[model samples]
Target: MDIVLAPLATDITCAPSTAVGQGGALIEARSDREAITRWLIEYRHSPATFRHYRKEAERFVLWLEFRGLSLDALRRHHLDEFEQFLTNPLPSSHWTGPTRPRHHPRWRPFRSGLAPASRRQSLVILQGLCGWLKEAGWVTHNPFALMRDRRRRLDNAAPPVIERYFEREWWCAMWKLLDPPVEDAPQRSRFLIARRRFLFGFAYLMAPRIAEISRARMNDFRLEEGQWWWHVVGKGNKVARLPVPDDMMTLLREWRAELGLSDMPPPHDDSPVLRALDRRRGVTDNQLYRVFKDGFSMLSDALIARNWSQDHPLIEQLRRATPHWLRHTSLTHQAQSGIELRYLAMNARHARLETTARYLHAENDEWQRQQARHRLSRIE
Candidate 1:
């Protein structure tokens, strides 16, 4: 099947007699592709949702094109086929990507395959898209509403929420390597690595999402009610006043000094909290991800060199680490350290206490040891 590239934004908005797809296939002007583009654009107000929903919608659209159908013509059976495709996308499907850009040969939507949780997420996004399109009179019906697969169901049978985070030992090891002696390397190269460490350190201490960190401005740091706090714009555009630890403030000051800035971040300063290496603008989410990823790789290699087996849980976990895992690590460590749930919830910026309680489920060695007191008696 020929791959379908999305119409450029201007192509959809401009008055055009015809549109083109890959291989010069003629698509009817103002078709389902345009409708899908409009739907995805409406979500641009929320960055996270825009990225996620656009992905699911794009994959679905590509599949529809492969079948030579339009979005309005999709039915329940088509969605079932889509689900199957998501589970194991055909190698030739060209719906995959390391980065979701078109024209990349490695672009399959799924790297390995979607887990049950990921499949549910994809279905939910499409369901919402279809619902919106139906309301707008673009589609005749919502096929997702009639999808009956067990994987698409939202009920008690759903898979457990597994929180991935670093333990205390792992955190310490990362920190040790993240910030080495200033003189250990050339001053120029050392400063660059130090900047990255501060970014990861901010995430660890504040537990902010990568997006929040990316958009974090110096003005967001302020002294409120006699305590230093970061006024972060988190998911859902909700503003959270997270308490900044004293040590973090010290590091901030030190890093700024290294940058030749003022001893403290001025209340009126509008610069990013995490500036790019160029020192002119804030780092993007992708740049921040690469920094943490590089750190994870370095730490994993260090451990392996120290004779830690590749099969060791900590080593293996590091190998699979993503930037968000650091947020989980921070919150989980705080819960383990006996921080009160109510306070931890506020610190974590979790809208619900139950969400924060997920960290309490992190395997507690002491709790497990105490529970081990009860054992079944063996028959002689």
Candidate 2:
């Protein structure tokens, strides 16, 4: 028989249970579910973090339900089994399904089995949860602690090299398609063309994440001390002020005019910078993601129509590109253009310098040049 488990509610808040763990309890949470909920509450202010942590925790709980075990009963062997399960997620009919509403009868814990990187991320989140639970006296031990080389396994010593970004030639080709001259523009509607130009321009120039752009309003862009700045609430609920270049300001003005607004946004105007075609409401992140996906698909079709092979590298890149690739492209290009590392980190809003350093490819180029000197017989 297939196992059925209802996903936890996002707004779950319940009074502490009376049960206690093996250790002297510090938190009031008694059951494993309640304890996990307590841990999730700490990240309530950070929606992205909360959602991610909750998903991993919920999946573990559901897996435990399948095995008829509890968090407190987990051991190194159980942890090992869970790690293996993450890779395959057996009984596919019960564990995997297409995306659906959380409350939908057909909703499943996973859309598919986790990839290696995703599995690592899932383990990292669960490790943190287990540590917290141990501190709260909800569990007797943390199974992650028993694993050898835990630090190397759980944390990346160096940031992974960024590969999911556009090359200059690819970016130029895409821009040509996006911002063709009036005489050369494709059959797309004027409104759509204008929106695409502004949307891509904003993404490439500001390098804001999809959520930041979707939630932005006209008031977020303001003239401050003779300079334009974009105020944004970024990841972890951190607020930042990013400098807006003259070209970006011009683009904003043109986009506003296209929307029938004044050249310069009026002070305190809360209108969304990007809006629905038939309505004034702001678009959701999912909608913005679709916009990028559709744009890439169109670009791919255009290339194919022009005799580009289906298996071309550029075509493959476009097929795999997601909205996040824009941020990667912007940062990587900025690094290549000689932007200092410190400023790049600030612009990217990364907490660590190492994270920003992943975009630096100058060292790789120099290394390649040095390696070229080594040969079976040096050519004079």
Candidate 3:
């Protein structure tokens, strides 16, 4: 393929022409291009990856400045400190998707759950940077060649809510049946709670990733052969079909009509399946999360109001109670409701049995204990 170098940050292509200055030095204002920067862009590493390189390099530069060593005079210790900085730097507010929003309704930082594999990926990139500097004869040695990290704990490689959210029965009642409070929210904000309850009930009950939900346009949903269904694009960009709840079908209808898009916009085949009050901003992963947070918080508040102590047997043993928890509830309810595992796998849209196995995580334990204590109830 022919190399196409887009001029970065300016109108000029490559470097501008330079003539010899009076002192017999080339009149170039900056140094010539390096090979690694070319490779980074050429390898299809995202612009965000390039941004990280600049930031990480700056961090290394700062550490070197504290020790009074310029890049030309930098040594192994400088690179090692930079590695440490990446592992446990200042709290990264730079995180995107679910964790980016500044308003922490709970007034706490999102817990950083970076996985071992992720840290390893970052470390490998740094090592590669060091290797490149050496190969290009820019450095005498690859400083990080011998340096190592105590690999980050294998963390949940998803946003925090993805790890913790589980929809139990108590939570469902709290969110769906009871409308929780929002502090000084605008009239439009009232939709926040409702959005969560129904969306959670609709989607997680069916188990589509937030990405699939966002990617789903009205065209992807259809009444195929008289059944309401969604054509979801799952992980790895694969397509899967899902059945939607009738109540959800209604919610979608009202929400669209309320927004008046039906007048200005076309039918189910013409617009996004999920949208916001403000159409242009679009739906986001964090929006998906904030939907849950509002739901969970409202639910938690409602349960407290209804004369149920957090210590009550039902509430007391609720190990998890976020939106994903509802997913567990949905699956368990289906299992108890006699939905087959085979059908559950398809409805849940999990590619592997082990992935769906997580949905069954607490079910077997809950079932056995319920059966042992209520053995007489099992008799028909």
* Candidates' C-alpha lDDT: 0.75, 0.85, 0.52
Q: Summarize candidate 3's per-residue lDDT along 26-52 as a digit string, tens digits.
A: 222232233234334433333334544
lDDT of 2: 0.85
**Global lDDT of model 1:** 0.75
Shift of residue 292 alpha carbon in model 2, Å? 2.5
Error of 2 at 235 (Å): 1.3
What value does the lDDT take at residue 103 in candidate 2?
77
Q: Which stretches of candidate 3 lie over 4 Å from their true place?
A: 1-168, 178-190, 261-268, 279-281, 307-329, 361-363, 366-380
**Candidate 2 vs 3: which has more TM-score:** 2
Q: After superposition, how far is residue 373 of candidate 3 from its true place, in Å?
A: 10
lDDT at position 112, candidate 1: 55
The list of candidate 2 runs beyond 4 A from truth reads 180-188, 378-380
Best by the TM-score measure: 2
Candidate 2 clash total? Answer: 0
Per-prediction tally of clashes? 7, 0, 6
